[model samples]
Target: MVDEASKDGLNALAQAAKQAPRDSPRDSTRRGLPPVHLWNPDHCGEIDIVIRRDGVWMHEGSPIARKELVRLFSTVLRKDPDGYHLVTPVEKLRIRVDDLPFRAVSLGREGDDLIFVTDVGDEVRAGPDDPIMVQTDPITGEPAPRIHVRRDLWARIARPVFYELVEMAEEVDGQLVVRSGGQAFPLGAVA
Candidate 1:
């Protein structure tokens, strides 16, 4: 069953977590990432882990409460056409992501730059490199907003945080746009 698989996967995750170096992700702006993009290690296997839409990391059919471990694993996370996977020097394990892998928990403004703090404590500033995008569900027609963190990874802006963004939006060309780093990112139409 999936439960058994999750248990085995958790053990692997725990072991892998220990191997991952404890580095300050807060300094990502100054230093580059771990070069997961460049590392094309062979796929080890699938891991029975799933990141829920609410930003919960589930292992062994239970939520992973260790924030530090989650942060460490996040460093190796990569996205490809197949799906999301956690990569290391020796192996790579595929993991299920119901939505985005991260959630934007808070937001701040410094001058013209907008900074977002993810649940795992990743701070990203919106600019040309990282941009905010809003996608409307085709079936439900509800807006789902996400902000790019690094490479191809994105953090879904939490609903309450999205409300704060809506409050800060300005009407430009009949579109709701928020300015950050002197760049304007359109949320959607002013409906």
Candidate 2:
């Protein structure tokens, strides 16, 4: 159960997140992300924001419907030692993330680079800096694939996108591997 003060703080943070794009001259849908890492505000708290496993942003148990708003909020998202936080110049608010925060919804190839576009409009090229990682679920033994986006943030490759990657993979030493930016990332054992 949330206390009244917490509720108020959550609502206020939501409002602030909404207003952030309007406060900026550039469009929130633009490619560049805010300097969230640089901000070290004195005020810190938690809100009801949760990034679901499927990459949907939920607030107070409801989905945040606006794409641009979500994009704006994504710009300020940062991961610290404790957890993920939405950082601004004035305040910092921790948020819950069930899995990762972003989803790699689309994939494209340019030259030798594999470019991934996140749901919130981040374009990350899989390379040494942003490597692809596949982890096996210990319980289900299913493959969970992810790609690094920026800083410590990552985008879970959507199933269809992962299938696309698999389609592009080649068998190398009994393992399925995909090449991007001169790096070979193993998908899994070729079964």
Candidate 3:
């Protein structure tokens, strides 16, 4: 459980994230992504922020309603070996993720490529760089599908979108595979 002081710290971090500039001159010069991967900030400790399975950000048992704040926080999100952390230039704070951090809410197609739009508005094209993977839940035997977004970050494909993928799937080597960017991503075995 998170203490009151930690909750206050999380609030401060959220505030800081909100105030951070999104499209500054320096950012414009960079073609894609802030170098969160290269940043080795000090661990400020874990905060009482959780990203729920349904894509809700919660702090101190309350939902964080500000979409811009959520978007800003998403920008700094990094998933390391230990778990997920919200990283800044100076500090990194651990946050709880019930499942995956982002959810792929919609899908589109550009010729042979499959484009996925995440809840945070990140557009991911599934290919060699970003591949679709589905893991079967051991207990429930359900498929948990995900797509790589950027640099080890992934978005859990929502069920409806997964259904869309199913519609596009074709049999390949007795496996249900979806073709995108001239690559075949196996959704699962034909059952």
Candidate 4:
């Protein structure tokens, strides 16, 4: 028959997931390890960034016309870096805010570092050598603390989810496009 606790656990996980973007994960896998946002997915395909307001929107979720949020734009580059230069234009960006939604803090390259400036400055980074982290509940136009992770762990856990989400980010041709890292072994093409 049905297990009540098991059912409840699944429901709780779903409830938490429903509140956030797919693959926009909050992992507590290793204690004392500052959380890394997990995005690994099983399949690899075209992916698009979703701009949802209010709740977790779908693949075809519409952007709320808020200039305070970052709408889909041409990517300067997607990173798979052990090391990256902070001065690259890939870092500089801004997003418009609306009523309520799963927001992203897009930091732009500033001088010798990337500045994660947002209304809720929960997630931010100053440079390449910084940590890739997420902070809960922040204010507008504020800079978040730096997020960091070990490089190998990042590749192992982070990469696959990115492939899946990137696949879902599939409107580049007037939609998103799924792309693999350039140096990926066997070079996973958008499949």
lDDT of 2 by residue, 1-191 (tens): 55688668756765665544333336443254556666688757787889999888988888888887788788888899999998876789889999999999999999989999999989888999899999997878899999998889999999999999999999999999999989999999998
Give the clash total for candidate 1: 0
Q: Which is better, 1 or 4, measured by TM-score?
A: 1
lDDT of 3 by residue, 1-191 (tens): 55778667767776766554444446432224456787788898887789999999988788888887787788889999999999877779999999899999999999999999999878888898889999987878899999998767889999999999999999998899999977899999898
Clashes of each: 0, 0, 0, 41
For each candidate, the alpha-carbon lDDT, in order, equals 0.85, 0.85, 0.85, 0.29
Clashing residue pairs in candidate 2, if any?
Answer: none
Tens-digit per-residue lDDT, 1-191, candidate 1? 34666566666766764565544558667243466776688998888778999999987578888888788778788998999999876678999999999999999999988999999888999988899999997878889999999878999999899999999999999999999977899999998
RMSD of 3: 3.3
Q: Each model's TM-score?
A: 0.87, 0.86, 0.87, 0.20
- Model number with the top TM-score: 1
The root-mean-square deviation over C-alpha atoms between each candidate and the true structure, in angstroms, is 2.8, 3.7, 3.3, 19.0
True-structure lDDT of candidate 3: 0.85
Task: Please report the TM-score between candidate 1 and the true structure.
Answer: 0.87
Ranking, TM-score, top scorer first: 1, 3, 2, 4
> For candidate 1, which ten residues in a row score worst on lDDT?
16-25
Candidate 3 least-lDDT 10 residues: 23-32
lDDT of 4 at 148: 32
TM-score-best of 2 and 3: 3
TM-score of 3: 0.87
